[model samples]
Target: MKMNLSCCLYLAMAFFSGPATIFALAPENEVTLHPTTWLGENKITAVHLPKGRTRRLYFTLKKKADLMSVTVSPCAVPIEWSLAVRTLKDKPPKKSHWTSKKSMPEVWWKGSGREVKIYTYTGNAVDTYTGPAYAPASIYILRLKSNERDTQVSAYLHEGPGPSGVFPELPPDPRVHTLGVGMTSVTLSWAPSSSVVVEEGQRGNRPYYEYCVLVNPKHNHRSLCAVREGSKKDENEQMRPGKELKKDWWWHQPDTPEDNESSSALWDNFEDPGCVCKDTESVCTVSDLLPDTQYYFDVFVVDKVNGTSVPYTGTFARTHEEARPAVTPLREGQVKWVNLNGDASSQNGERSFRFKPRGWQQNGLLTMHTCNGTGKVKVTVSTKGQELTTQEVGHELAQIWLHGGPSYLIQLQASHSDKSRFCLRMQASSAYHRRAVPVFPAMLQIKSFNRLRTCNSVTIAWMGTEERSLYCVYRRQIPHGSGKHSSTDRCLDPESRPASERVLCKYFQELDPRRAVTTAVISELDPGVLYVFDVYLMRRWGLPIKYHSKTLRTKSEC
Candidate 1:
C-alpha cells in the first residue's frame, strides 16, 4: 500500500498530533513489548510516552543473527529522551524499573538515534551462541523513556549487519555571501539548497529542512550561538517548536590558554547575533554588530525532523567604521557658518573643528547656534586631549569659556538625520568691553613694585605706563656672591641671548595697565637664590622700553 504525498503529510501530521488525545488514557507504568513479525525486517513503529513514563519494545529472531539494531527518533521538540537496548533469552523481567540498572535487563548496547550495534559469533567454547543451533532464538528489548514532558517517538527495528539508512542524508554546504555591511548590521545572501528539490521529488513530500546563520567572533574557539525552544516559526507562523541540532555545524578551533587570554576576542563581552531562515528565503540581515570588527559567518542546513546537520560553509566580513569628516580649522575672533545642504556634510552627520585662541585672547567664549535645522545639535568641547563640556543646542545659543595656549577640539554632531545649517563664533569676552585708545608714550617705567615669595615661587606686581600694551617679563638668576647687578644697556631679547645666558621670558597683555595692577608669577625657582626681573614695554615699530630692575629671593626649603 503506497501513500500519496497528501496522505503522507497528513499521516505525519496526525502522528505528531494524535498522541495528545490518548495521553490521558494511557497508563504511565505500562511496559508492553510490541513485536515485529519476522527477523531481519525493517519496521518503524510509533509510541506515545507520557512525561516520566517508559515504553518497551522487542523483536525476535528465529535463528541466530549476527546483528541487532534499534533506533529511536523523538519528536521535533526541545525535550529530553533516551534509548536503551538489551537481548533477552526467555522473557523480560516482570517488574523492571527503568532507572534501576540492577532491576532492569543487562543492556547490550545504548544510543540515541541512527546508531547500529553489531555482534559476531566466535568459534570458542566460552562463546554461548557460536552457531544457529547453539542457543534458542534471541529477543532484543528496547526501552525508551521521556523526561519533562509527554513525547512521541518512532522506533526502527533492524536485524542485519548494517543500518538501513532510515534518516535522510545531510544537504550540501551553503555558499554564503555578504549583501551589505554596516556599522551595526550585516546583510547576507545565499543560494537555496538543491537537495531540497531533489529530496522532495524522490520522497514525494517536502523534507523538513531549516537554515540557520551563525555569527562568531573571528578566530574564536568557543561558540556563542545556541538553538532554543520556540525559536523557529510554527505551522501557524506564530509559535513553532525548536531544538538544538548537532554540534557538527558549529565552527571550533583548539582552545589554548593563549586563545582565551583576551576578553575582546571572546563573546562574553558582546552579543553573537544570528538568525534562522526558511528554505525559500535566501537572504537575512543580522543586527547589533560592533563597528569596524571582523567576524566569521556560518550557514548551516539542519534536518529539523531527524536532528541531523552538516558542516557549515562560512566566510568573513568586516563592518564599516563610523563616518567622520576631516577636522576643520577654526580661527579666533571669526564667525564660521557651515552649510550642510549638499555634499559638504559628513555622511554620518558628524563634524569636528580645531581651534586655538591667540596668545592675547586668553579669556574668550565659544558659541554654537543652529540657524536652519529644526532639531538640536550636540556640541562637544575638548582641550588638551580632555573633554571639557558637552551640550545639546538648537536655535538657542550654547556657549563655553575658552582658554589660550592649548588647542581645543570642538565637535558638532546632529541629533537627527536632516540637513542642517549652523554657525560657530569664537571671540574674546573683552571684545564686548569698551576699547582703549591706542597711545604711544615717549618713556615707560615700572612703578609701585611689591613682591610675595614662596619656597619655590615669587609673585611680582607693578604698574606699567600704558594699557592694551604687550609686556615681556625677563628673569635671570644672579650668581652666588658675584654681586653683579644686570644693567639695562646689556639687556638683550631672551631669544637673542646666548644659550648659556638665555633668560626666561613670559609675555603678558596689560588689559588695564593704568587701574588694575599687572601681576606675574614666576614658579619653579631655586630656593635661597636671588633673581632679577625686568619688565619691558614691547613696541612693534621700535625698541622695547625697559623698566627699572628689581631683585627678589625665594624662601629657604621648609
Candidate 2:
C-alpha cells in the first residue's frame, strides 16, 4: 500500500526567541564583586614624558579570580613596564621586586612592551595586556617606564564585564505597564534599568545611556521608537564602541568625558534622585491613540560602554479598552505514544509519541510512570530524533524538561533485565491559545547543498541569494521501517509514511548577508539513519524560498 505521510508544520516563530539580548555567559566569564575604579581620582592627560623616573599604577585586586589580562583604553602610546606583588602590609614594588623573569606570552603587535607588564599600542585604543601567571588576591603594582612622559594612559583591571557590564542572562526588568491610559494616548513605563556601567577597574562610570522604546499601536503594522536619536539612521547603525544593539536601539560607545558622568553616585553608593511622579520622559508615551486602542510597548536597555541588554519583557496596553489578548498560550493537546517493537512499552522497546500542541508549548515535560525493576533501566526521550532527555527510569514517575518540536520518541533500554514494561500518563495544563499566522516560503532558494558527517554530527553548508533576510533550517530522520512487529521477530513497515516526518527545525535570523553562503552544524543525531534537510530563506521584503536536500546518511558510530 502506498503510504501518504503528512508533513509536520514547524513554527520557526520569533516569539520563542524571546529577546536577542539574552545571551548565555561562557565558562570563562566571571563577575567582580569588589572592584576598584581605575583612574579613580587622577585626571591624566596625554603629554610627552621626560622619564628617568617612572609613573607606576598600584592596583588592589578584589575578587580572588586570577587575572587573565588587563585591558587598557587610550591605547595610543607605548610604555615599558614590570609587575610586582605585595601584601597589604608591604610597600609598592621598588627596583628590587622587579627581578622576576618573563612568564606570560607577549605579542608586541597588540600592546605588550619588552616586559610582561610593559605595553605599547598606538591612542584611544583597546587592547588586553599580558598578566603574570600568579596575581594573588592582594595588591599588585604595575610599574610603567615610558620614553615620552606624555603618553595617554587609562587602564582597567577587569574581573568580567564588571558590575554594570554585560548581563549573564537576559534582563528581567521592565515588567511592563500601560500607564495613564486615556482616550488620546497612553504611557508605557518599565522598571528603570541602571545606565551606570561598572568596569569596576575602569575610568569613570557613564550615566547617559539611552532607552529605545518601541510602540506598536494595535490595528497598525507600523512600529517606531518614541525617543529617536539624532542620526535618524536605521536602528542598527548607532553604536557606542564595544556596545551592542537590539531590535529597538543601539548605544554608541561612550568615550567623551563630558558625555560620560560619574555614576559613582549610584555605583559606589546609592543616591536616588527624588522621584517626580509627573515624569514621562524616561517612559515612552504614544500619543494620538484611539479610544480603547491597543498597543505593545517594548523597551531595550543600551549601555554606553558594554552594549545592549535584552529588551524588557514586553507589555500590552490599550487606550480605554486597555486590554488586548494577542499573545498565544500553549495548550496541552493529546499525546500518543506507540511502541516500535510491540503494542506495549516493554523493556528494550523503542516507542514514539506524537503531540499536536493546541497553542504555545515550549520548555514543557512529559511525565511517565514506570515500574521499578531490578538493576538500572535507562529511558531516553528524543525530539526530532535528537536526544532531549535520558535518565534511569527507577522511580514511579520520571519527568524531564522537554523542548517541544512536532513529535517526541521515548526509548526504553534495560541494562540487565527485560521482563518489566513501563507506562506513561499526561499531567499537562491548558493555557490560553495564541495562534500566529503561518509564514510561507520565500522566492529565493539556497543552492550548493552539501553535507559532511564528522565524528558524531553532520555539518551542512549552502548558499543563498537573498540579503538582509532570515533563514530557517529543517531536518528529520526518515524512519526506515514501522516500529510494529510482525508475528515473527521482524519489524513491520509503517502504514503510510508519516506525512513528511515530524520536522526538527531550527531558526537563524538576521543573517549578515542573506545572499552569501551559510553553514550550520547539527549534532546529537541518531547515527546511520538517513535524514533530510530543508533550507528556507525569508528576505526583508520578498516572499520566502525553500530548498530540500537529497537523503544524507550520517557515519555510524562503531
Candidate 3:
C-alpha cells in the first residue's frame, strides 16, 4: 500500500510542472517603445553602458503568459539572456534572485513575463522586448534606449567675381544689382531663419551663431583664409546676458510664439554685418588695400539647428591712385631723339613740331617734353590725351603723361638705321594724371581701285596712319607696271589731291588711336586700267619709312 501511494504523488507533480512556471513575474516590465530618431541620414546613435549598471525595460501586457521565461532581442547583433523570471501580482511569493548560466559576451539581456534586463552592450544600440503580462492591464511607457551619436562640423565654401579695389552691397535681387566699381568694404546680409522650439518639460537655451570670410588674391580657386570667422573688438565685451534670462532667450523657443533676438551683433563683433543675421543684411568692410589690383572673397553663415548655410558671395573694386604714370600717342611721336650734340640747345626754351591730323580734330594730340640733365624744356602746344605736357618736363627720369584722347602706341624703343636703340621713359604729372582720359584704338582702312578704258576694274584694301607724309598713285598700260611703280608717279599730298588727278580716299590726324577712323576714297576710273597705290609713314623723330599696297582691274559694268 505505501509503495503505491508514493507512485501516485510523483505522477501528480510531473503533470502540474508546466502550468506552474508560466505565471512567474519580475520586478520591472517591458513597455512599447517608439523607433529611434536619427540626427542625419548617415548617423548612428549609441551610448557607453556604465560599469555594473544593468538596463531595465517593460512591455505592455498583450495576451496570456504560457512560457517559463521572457527574452529581449538585440538591435545590431545577437545577444543572450542573463536572467529571466515571471511573477504573479495576486500571489505574494518569496523573494529570490534567479541568475542565468550563459555569461554576457560584450552585451547580454534577459526578459521575464513583461520585463527585460540588458547588460554589457557597448557603442550605439536600440533594443526591443516581446512578451505578455498578467491581467489588470493599463498602457505604460517602454524603456527602448540607445547611446549618443557623434557630431562634427562639415566645412564648405562659396566664390564670385570681385572688383579691383572696393566691393558693392548685396543687392535685394542678387542677379540684378551688382557692383561695377571697387569699394572700400563689402557687406553681407541674410533673410530671417526660424529657430527650433522646446516643449513644456524641456530646458531653455540660447542659439549660438558663427561665420567665416575669405579673400582670394590670385583667384586661384582656393580659399585664402583657412578659417575666416568675424572678430569682435575689445571694446565690445560688456554684452553678455546676466543670471536669469527670459523665455525668448532660451535655446528651444519655437519660431512662431517667442521672439528671439539674434546674436549677430555679438558673433559679428560689433562691426559691419558679415553674414551674422538672417533677418537683416550685413556688410563686410575691408581697408588698407592696394590700387589697380583685383581681389576675390567668400562668405559663410552658421546657425544652431541646421549648422552652416551654403556660402553667399559679393565683390568690390577700389578706385585708382591720385597720380598714375601714363603716356599718350604711345607709338607715333613728334620729337623723337636729339643726340644731346653738346651744342644742341632749345632756341628760347621753346620746342614745337607739327603733323597734320587731316580728318582728325587738332585737339586730340597731346605733347610733353623731358630733358636728360636740364638744358632747356618746354611744350609749344596742347590738345586732348593730356594737358600741361611742357610744365611736366624734368631732368630726373621725367615722364610725359599723354591722353591721346584716342588709341596711340607710344614708341617705347626705337632703332635707327644705324642700329642705335633709344628707350623713351614716361612719368606722371599731378595735373596731367588728374585730367587723363580713356583712349581707344583707331582703325584706318585705305581702299583703292583701278579702271582701264572700257576694260577691267580691280580693288585693293589697306590700312593708313595719321603719320603718312604723302601718297603716290601710279598708272601704266600693264605688261610693264612691274615692280617699278614706286618710281612712276610724283608723291601727292593726300589732303589736297583732287578727284581728277588722284582721288583722296582717307585723311586723318590728331585722332584717338583708341577709336576707329577711315580714310578718304579715290574713285572715277576708266575701264581695263592698271594702277598701283603706295602709302608712306611721315616720321618726325627717327628715320622715315614708307608702307605700300596696290590693286589692278578693268572698269566695272554700268
Candidate 4:
C-alpha cells in the first residue's frame, strides 16, 4: 500500500552528518617510527647529547618533530625546552636559533618511577634548540619531517588517549558524539585539519589519508576488530573481525562477550566512498551492529605524513528489536480521526460510525475531529472507540501523499474503553482530505497572557488551553465613523504556491512527551491596527472545524 514520505526527509537529516576526513602527511614523509606489531619492543632505546656535540637533524624540508624521552626527575625540578635548526643546502651552513614557545613549562612529576618527556616543534625557521631537556638521556622521538623546502609550524601538546605522535587533531572527532554501549561496534569522527585555501596560480596540497579506528574491550582491554578505511559492503562476512575488504576501514569483534549483552552483532566499521568525492563529496556506511549492545569508539585521522589524531570516543546502546507502532490514548477534550470511503454520514444522536474497512485510501478518506471548547460539546473522534486526555499523545497520525493510487485498510479506535459516554461524534463531509475525529465535544479557554514594552517595540503574548494542538493569529480594524480608513491593500493573500505561503506565521514542536497547548507572541503589527488572535487544538490536519480559543484583541502601541 502507498504511504506518504514527504515529512521523513527532515528527520533523516538530523541523524547522520558525514564521514570524517583523513589527514595524511606529505608524500614519502614519515610521521611515526613504530615497527609493525611483529617488531619486538619497537621503541626508542637511547638519546645521546654529548656536551658541545650538537645532534643535527638533516632533512630535505622543515617539519614538526615529536621527541620523547623517559625521564626521572624530582617533582620540584624546573624543566625548559626550545628548538634549533640549520640549513644544509644553504651556503656556509647558516643556523637559526629560537626558544620553544609553550605555556606552563613546568611538567609535574606524577609520583612515578619514570616520566616521558615530549617536545613539539612548529616553526621551520630555526636550526637548533637549547633548553633544560635538550640534553636529556634515553629520549625516543617520533618526528614528522616534511619533504618540501618552505613550510609552517607550531607546537601543540598531545592530549587524550594513545601514544604521542600517532595522531593529529581533526573536526569530525569532536562533532559526532554519540556512543552505543553493549553494541558490537561504534563509529567516531573528527573535523579535518585543513581545507584548500584558493588563490591565483597556486594549487593547494590534496592527498587522500588513511583512517584506523580501533575498539578495545573496557575490562580486559583486548583488541577487537580493526577495519580498513575503504571497504565493500558485506554484512555476513563482517559478523566477526578479520581482514576487511575495505582499504583502511575494518571490523573487529570484542575479545570477550559483553557483560550485559543483546542479540545482534555490531556493524562498526564504515568505509566512506571516495570516487564521488573527486567532485568534492563522498558517502560512507557502517552496519551490522549488535542488538542492544553498547560500544565505545576512538577514531584516528591519518595522513601521508603518518600524522594521526588522538582518539575521540562516545557511546550508544542499540535496541533489542526495532520498535513497532501501537495506539496510545488521547488527551481530554482532544479528538482524532480515521477516514473511510464517503459512504457514512452523521445523523441525529448517532454521530459516530466505525471506519475499519478495506481499500480506504483508494476508495475514500476517514476524518476525525475533537472539540476543545471551554464547555463540553459532542466530541466523536473515533467511531470504533474513544478516550479522555489532559495532555497530548507522544505519537501523532502519519500520512503519505503519492501518485499512482494504492489500496489500503483504515482502522479507527476509541480513546478510552468507555462506550456509553460517547462525548465525541463524527460525520462524513465532502471535504477532499480526511482525518481522525474525536469522540467528545471540548470547552476551549484562554489559559494566560503577557505584555511587554520596550524603547523600540511593544509585544503581546497569550497561553492556550492545555489541549491545544495548533495556534494562529489574525487582525481587524476597529469601528470608526467619519474616521479616515486608509485602504492601502492591507489584506494578505493566503493562496500562493506552497513555496510562498506565509499563513503559518510561527510554530513549535515537541516530540518527547506530546503536550498539546503552546504559547506564542505576534510582532511587527501596525500601531493603528487592532490585532486579534486565536489558538486551536485539533487532532488531525486539514479538518477546518476546530475547538478554537476566545478571540483576544491587542491595543496597538509601539
Candidate 5:
C-alpha cells in the first residue's frame, strides 16, 4: 500500500497533537523494556539522534529500589543534546526549549560536545518536580533531543542494590524438532525451558517465561542468536553484587526507540515472520509460508517480567512441494467412488483429483468421508487457477458445491505427517439435459400456499413419486413482454440465462424414499413483480428432466 502526500501530512498532524496521538499513529514504535534493563546495568549504544527529532524511552519498576541512575554520552563527533526524565504523573513541559531555566528541574542536562552526564536518585522518596527519582511500581520516561546536527550517542541505566535474592539465570538453549511439514506450513515442537528458581534462604520464587519463534527465509549466523552482544560472560567477567555490568548492542535493536524513529520510513515494506507462543506452549505451527522453500527458525525463551530473552539456534525445515493432480474421467450418468491412502514419509500426505464436466453435465457435487485414520484431512477446490472453497473434515460427511463449470480440481491433504485415509464420491449432472426421457409422466408436483405468500417472499413445496433422486429449483423474473400467466413444459438452462432474465436462486437437494414432501423459501422479491420458478429432476447422465413449473406475483404492499 502506497501512502500519498495527503496521508503523510495527516500522519504528521496526528503525531504532534500529543504523545497518545503519536503512539496511536505508530504503535510499533513503543517498546517495552525488560526490568533487568533498569535493575541491572544496560547500555544502548550507537543510537542516531536526528536533528530536530526527539526520542523517548520508557521503563517501569515493579518493586522498591534504593538507588536509580542514568548516564548519557555522545560518540564520535561532538554534538549538542538535551535529556529529561519524567514519571507518568508529570505533565508535559509548556516551553519549547529544553535549556530554559523553567525546564532545569525537569530537564536532567543540556550539554554540547562529547561530555558525559550521570543522574542519580536514592531511597523511596521521588522528587516529582526535579531530578531523576526512584519509586516502586511506577513508570518513568527518558526523553532525549538533538540540536544543530545529527549525531550518535550511548545511554546507560542502573538501579541498586539489585534484588537481594539470587537473580534468575538465562534459560538454556532448547532442542528443536520438526513434527510435520505441509505445502505452506510447518509444525515444530521443543522442550520447554527449565524454570529458574530464585532462592533467599527458606523462600524460593520461580519466574514466568514465554517463547518466541523467529523465522527467516535464509540461514542466519550462530552469533546472531545471542540476545545481547558480549553477553556470554565467563565467571571472571561476571559483575559482582552492586557492580554495574553493561551489555551493549553490537547491532541496532529493532525495538529501540531511536531505531524505531530512524526506520519508520521503511515500515511500509518490512515483513516480520515471527510468532510468540504462550508461556506453557512448547509446540507451534508456523503457517502462510512459501512451498518448496527452506526456512530457518530460532526459538528464544523470554523472561515475562524482565523482557529478557535467550536464543536457541540451528533449526531449519523445508515445506513440501505441490503434487501434480491426478485426472479422473467421468462418464455420463455414472457415479464414482475413490479411496485415497497415503503416509507422510512417502507421499507428503497430499493427493489431488481433477475432473472435467463432459457432455451436458455442468453441475457437480462432491462428498468426502474420512475413514479410520491417524490424521485429519483438508479439502480444497479450485478451477482456472481460482480457489472456490476449502474445509477440513474428519470421520464425518462433508459436502462441497461446485458451481456450473467446465472443469474443477480438488486437493486433499492430511493435517500432519501421519497415515491418512479418505473416501470421496463425486457425481456430475446437467440442469437441462435434452436427451433423457422420463419414466413417469406425472411423478412430481410443485405447489405454493397463498397463506405463506408475503409481499417479498413465498414458500414452495414439492412432492415426487420417485425416491433416491436429486432435485433443483430455479427462479427468474418474468420479462416485461411475457404474459404473467404463461407456463412452459421445458426447463431453461440456469447457466445460460438471457440478458433479460436472471437466475435468482439455484440450489439442489437429495430426497430419501421415505420422505413425502420437501419445502423451500424463495425470498428478496420486488413487490408486485412476477416470477417463474422451474423444478427439475437431475439424472446421472444426459440432461435433467423438467418436472414442474409455476408463476407467482408478490403482493404490491404488505
Candidate 6:
C-alpha cells in the first residue's frame, strides 16, 4: 500500500548545529613524535632525545613547505599542558621569542582525554599569531613543559591556509534522547551534530555520516531452554544453560578492555540504512528487530574526519511481544486477540491462536510464555497449518515466526504430558518503503503552493506520510480583508464554522510516482477577497500532520 513518509522527516529536533564542511583526511604533510629528555633512562636508546634538552621539537618538512600551520594533540596526558610555537631561524631564536603561547584546548568528544593546540600563520601578517612569517624553507620548533613525563603528541600540518585554518571538530558523541522499542523496530532521535567550517569554497565539509550500530542480547528474551530436572537425578534439581543459537548468545571475545567483560562474538552488527546521513541530521529508526529480547545498542559516530569515534553505549531497550498500530488511538494495554482453539481442557492439548493483519505489509510473529511445568512446545502457523517450528516452553518464552501473510494460525502443544499454561501474544509491523527522504527535511517546505488559473483558485502539493490517505484543503476569507502575505494572525478552526462559512476541499491520493506525494486544489471562490488556506494530511493512523498555511487573494473578477 502507498504510505506517506513526509511527516517523519521533520519529526526530529537537532541538539547541535549541523556540520559545515567535510574533513576527509589530514594534509599530506603530517608527523607524530614523542619528545624525550636526555636524562631519561632511554636517553642513549634509539628513541631518546639528547640529555639536558628538557622539552623541544626540531623537524624539517620532507617536501617544499606550503603556507600551513601545525596542530598538536597530546596523547595520554592526565593533566593540563601548554606549548609555544616558533620558526627556527639561523640564529636559533631564544625560548622567550616563541609565538602563539597558550594552553592547549580540551577535546570533549566523549570526555576530554587529550588537549590539542593549533598554530596559525599568514604571509607577512601574524594573524592570531605573534611570531615571524612562514617561509618555504623554515625549521619549526615547539617547546612543551608539563608535569607529565615525556610529552607524547600527534600533529597534523594542514597544508596552506584553509579557512581560518580552523574547523569545528567532529560533532560530539550523539545522545539517544528518545527511543521507541517495538517488537520489530527501534526508533531513535538525537540532536544534530555540530557544524564545522572547512576551507574557502568548501561549503559542506562532510556531507553526512552514519552510525555503526551493534546489538548484543542481554540474555534470552525468555528463560534459557529448561534444564532437565532431578535431584541427584530429580532432587539434585540440575539446570543447564540454554542451548540457543550462536546468534542468540553473547559473543565470545578473548580480548576486552581492562574492565570490560563482554565478548565480541555475542554482538549482532546491524548496518542501519536509516542511520546513515550525508548532512547535519539526526534521528533514525531501525526495523526487523526481535521481540521480548534484551539488546544493548552500541553506536559509533563517523564523520568527515577519516577517524571514527569510540563506541558510545546507547540505551538498553527491549522489544515487546506485540505492537499496536499507530493508526487509531487504542485504550492502554488494549489488544485484539482471536481464539484459534479456545479448548483449555488439558494443558497438553493443542491450543491455537490466530491474528488477522489489516495491511498487506504486516508481518506476524507468535510468542508464548509457559509457566511451571517444563515442557517443549511445537508450533505451526500460516494461512494453512503447514509450517512447523519448535521451542522449549517450560518456564520461558518461546517465539515462532509465522511467515506473515493474510491471516495466520498459531498452534501450540506441549511435547510431553506436563500441564503448562501458555500465555500467548502476536506481533505485526508495517514494512514502509519511501523514496529519497531528506537527511534534514525541516527547512520550512511545501512540495509546491501555487496560484492556479486565478488568485481565487490555488493548488498545493506536499510530501505524503505513512497512511495519510486524505488531504483537507480549507479556506476562510481573512478578517479585515488583509492582502496576501499580510499578518492574518489568528487561529480559526474551519471545521468549527458552518459549511457555508468555510470552503473544505477533500482530495484522495493517486498512485505515487517516485516519493509519496499528494496535491489538492480549491477554486470558485469570490474574486479579490483575501483568504487563508490551511492544509492537513489526514492519516490512517495517529494524528493528522499539518503543513504551513498560505495566505492569498483572488484576482478581482472586475
Best by the TM-score measure? 1
lDDT (CA) per prediction: 0.52, 0.42, 0.32, 0.29, 0.53, 0.39
- Per-residue lDDT for 1-558 in model 6, tens only? 123454343332221222211112333333323322221110111122222244554433434435544443332332232233333223322432122122111111122233223343212110122222353233444444335444333334344344222323333654554367778777766544343223212654424333444344541110000000100122222233543322221222212252122212112231111122223335566566688876655444433333322223266677788532122222212232222222334532555555654445544334444322344455555465555455454333333444435656555555565343433332332223322211211222454454363755766566654332566666667655343464322222233445764455565533443455666666786777777666655433222334566766667863
- Judging by TM-score, tell me the better candidate of 4 and 6: 6
State residue 182's C-alpha deviation in candidate 4, in Å.
Answer: 17
Q: After superposition on all CA atoms, what RMSD does each candidate show versus the true structure? A: 21.8, 36.1, 24.1, 32.3, 26.2, 36.3
Candidate 1 structure quality by residue, lDDT tens digits, 239-358? 235644322123232244432343233233222134343443567777777789887776655444443333345677899997667898876554565544322345546677887654
Query: Model 5: per-residue lDDT, tens digit, 1-558?
Result: 366988898878887787777545544433333221231245333356788786655554436555655545443233443333333333334553332322333332222112123333221111112233444423455555566556555555655544211112333544678899999888888765544332222233332444566566655323221212113322226566766754321122244454344434323222232443444467878787788999887666544443334455448999999766565555544444545555534554656667665455555555445534545667888888899888886653445656656777877766655455545444344334432333332345679988989999998877653435566677777766676666652424344445444333334333443454667788887888888887765545434455556889888889
Off by over 4 Å in 5: 1-337, 342-350, 358-362, 365-380, 384-401, 404-406, 412-425, 430-538, 541-558
Give the local distance difference test score of model 3.
0.32
Query: Count of backbone clashes for each model?
Result: 0, 38, 95, 124, 4, 36
Q: Which ten residues in a row have the lowest lDDT in candidate 4?
A: 70-79
Residue-pair clashes, model 4: 124
Can you give the TM-score per candidate against the true fold? 0.37, 0.20, 0.24, 0.22, 0.26, 0.26
Q: Of the pair 4 and 5, which is ahead by lDDT? A: 5
Tens digit of lDDT per residue, candidate 3, span 1-558?
999999998767766875444334333342213322211211222222233333333222334432212212222222222333333333222232322112111011232224333233232111223333334232222222333321111211111122111111222433211234343333333332222111112434433433334443432111111122111221133345543421110011225322233433223222332222322223443443455656554544344332223234434344345332234432343345433222212222222233333224322333333333333333323444444333433332233343443332332211112222222223221222233322222322345543322444344444444343333443334444465444222223233344444434233444433432334344565655555554433332222222334545555565
